[model samples]
Target: REQADLQRVFPDLYMNSLSNVLTQGMNRKKKHEVEALAAVVSWIARSVGANTVVDVGAGQGYLAQVLSFEYQLSVIAIDACSHHGRITNARAERIKKHYAAKMHKSRSEDRNLNMPKTVTCRVLSTDTFKTLSDSLLQKDDLQKANLTGKGVGEHSLEGLPDGNVPSCCVDSKPSLLLAGLHACGDLSVTMLRTFLECKDVKAVVSIGCCYNLLSEEVENADSQCGFPMSKGIKSAGLSLGKSSRDLACQSAERWRCLGKDAGLHNFELHAFRAAFQMVLFRYYPEILITSPAIGRQGKALRRQHHQRILESTLHHEESAHSSPSLSQKNCKKKGSCPTMNSAEAGTAKNKGTFEIPLSDTGNSTPKSCGAADFASSILEMDALFRGVSFNQSTKCEATKSVDKYSLFEKFSRSGLCRLGLHHLQDINFAGLWKETEPFAELIGPYWSLRAALGPVLETILLLDRLLFLQEQGNSLEAVMIPIFDPTLSPRNVALIAKKI
Candidate 1:
């Protein structure tokens, strides 16, 4: 059956919701996400008679803000990042002021119109669920007031600055719906576990992201991972490696963008990376190692492809060992060396070919290799790999250079693999270029295909969590539900469960 048919068959199960007044100032994507999430949580909250909500990984508290102000449900927005909490509090306060002014204007305009009670939002910068008992422990009204000194329902001074306590700390509010909007990786699993462990959390709504960041339970096949949490799934010996999990996170929306005609320019970088990887392996066969990936550095290299590599002005202890002769010509007595940026690179386009020199047959001592030769090797790799042809005139510039041989060799031995060499088998120029050309052509479709399987893979992962929740007891109703638009928000599926 079609998706529409599935929606028709299980309308309530899907937990569809419409955006409301709370979404007024937010962006379109965020507004839609907050609206859908809040509506579903409100429905679940009403079903379970939960007036309080504990939002885990509530960065900026978008859902929490909506639940508290629009739905009139008291919410505790919890995040580990203090910066995020501060921003959330500031935004909430600004919105509250705007809404208050709007309400006052409405009341003066028409006395007949009903005025809703003013709502407040509080942000707590701590992992609230980590110490559940400490936060949730009950105390006498007088004792609680003294312990907190704040009014009952007002923010408490528990583990947060300026008298901010989690909603769970409000002793009078025992029942709460635990919710997380795209709580990343292990945190999503943590939310589900907390729901089962804590009796006060009446229900849970979890939308997870960053599957690749999940911690594995068992190191090998014998060990259990965070995913496949259900006993049956674990018993079946199922596992998704970090690579597979990353594939599951590829965005279909990005693939659609790449499918457009304008996306043709994007292919050049991929082809260049592929060619560069071949070059790395051809000269340094040991560089094909993949365990310690060049992750963020590789991405930076790709994004800033046009940046020219100035001779090593900055030296790390590790890189310093490779070469000691620092160039004085390019290096003035005091100032820093000039590096390439977008504007500079745009004006001076270099398209000349870079030739890799063959190793000397004679036993030439490491000291004999001059800085110019090392600089040539470094520029050759950096220029071609980064998709920028180096200005041959600048090649002769006496710039401080590191011994590329010892540097990359030691790097390879230490398991630091170059990017784009992950599945690269052949290092031949003609063959690699030919494979890269077709590979570039197929990237759009290949990316889309991987993205297409995302929801299916995500469903499997969610079902595993839900099944684990159900296995805890028969008194639970747990299932994966579509809560947001998939195209607009790739992490649109949510795992919602209530203790029946």
Candidate 2:
């Protein structure tokens, strides 16, 4: 209910001290997530007296391996992706072999190098949400388990070598701890519902990610829904739009690495695209009929433009007689270089600048006609579009109408097939620059403020799931805990609930 660090919530669980051989190779992010989630699940298992764990969306069986091998718990890892099951099975075998080798060395007397049934990977035929009830423990599965055996008993490895392990279901109700590490979208919600419906599931530790993939209740069935689980929030009509949900999934660590300048560049890039759209609108009035989805294509275009600009600046500075090699040397040494400012760019004669006029007037004035470099840039842009096999008719029209978009129009139209370009027809370099300067200055802080509120959004979503659990009446107590270091894993909070 209140803010608490992950360590504060699970103090008993410690990191696994893996020897060199047993240290399975994984990236730093994965290593941290596995260690932290293992600890939390270990703690939850102990608290609930649960030995069997059901891991949904178990990619490569990393968490399952931790629970079964490290924590000495029985685990069934389920994923809809069949390919992942093969990888999981392979990893599980490797870990088992490593453990066996270690055990054989320590105790030469015991020849029973039989693998532990620490974990089993299963490919789910049903949807991820239906996995709990439809694909639970079977009778044959219980037989394979040797469930009656004492602590740390050897589990059968009969069918694992070929990756054909059957789903194990218990006839009598057995205690279960359901877990999902970064279960995307509706999968996490499914786990919450499973804990409520299935009495055997004693506790749950769900850490969700990819909020953008979540289905809106109004648009989807109750079974398929991912948001507005709590009655309070549901009654208040709370909803996170696609963009907001996508924003919620952003990592703070990545933001810190980008710093202020790169972030601002990205913001300014959007306005540039918007202005470019206006240019297209003037030439092609048809573009205004609908709103086209530019999406990441605009970002890519902006990045290319930015890169071209940098190259141009470096080239110009390098060719100058006085500062012939100064710019090049400085850029190479310090990874920093002077770039042409917008103010200077507007006045530069032979450099590529946004000096293209919106008017079709045949005036000889310099302001009415584009610079040679600008015209060349437009030609280069057009060549790039042609390289991608974009529609030639649209390209011809764009070129015939305006010299500025000679090549740029096809690139923009290829990505944004809708009508948004019409509005940008009137926006020119000077006016767009004037409009974007203030916006560019303020956007960084605005995005940061929005990012600061991400945790609150995460909290609300997790709490809603917890509230749903409480309302189920099966779970005695349901609470959300910060189970991982926030700096390491942005989506660190986990919803944990225990049965009566």
Model 1 lDDT tens row, 1-500: 01122334344634334334455557777876786777778778988998567777777677777777667676766666656666666667766776677778777534222111111223221244534423534432223322342322323335344334333455465676888888888878877877777777789999889998876553354443467678877777777778777866866655564423224434443444445555566655675564324433234443444323323213322343554344333233222223432233213223544332222111221232244433333344443333222232333232223222322332221121333223233324444455545565575456456668865666667778878888887888887766666667777777888998
TM-score of every prediction relative to native: 0.59, 0.61
- Number of colliding residue pairs in each model: 2, 10
TM-score of 1: 0.59
Candidate 2 lDDT trough over 10 residues, lowest sum: 387-396
* Candidate 2 local lDDT, 232-278, one digit each (tens): 66777787878778777877655665534356545544544665566
Clashing pairs in 2: 137-168, 137-169, 138-168, 138-169, 278-424, 278-425, 282-425, 287-419, 290-419, 382-407
lDDT of each: 0.54, 0.57
Q: What is the lDDT of residue 260 in candidate 2?
A: 41
- Show model 2 residue runs off by greater than 4 Å: 1-8, 18-25, 108-135, 139-173, 218-224, 252-258, 265-442
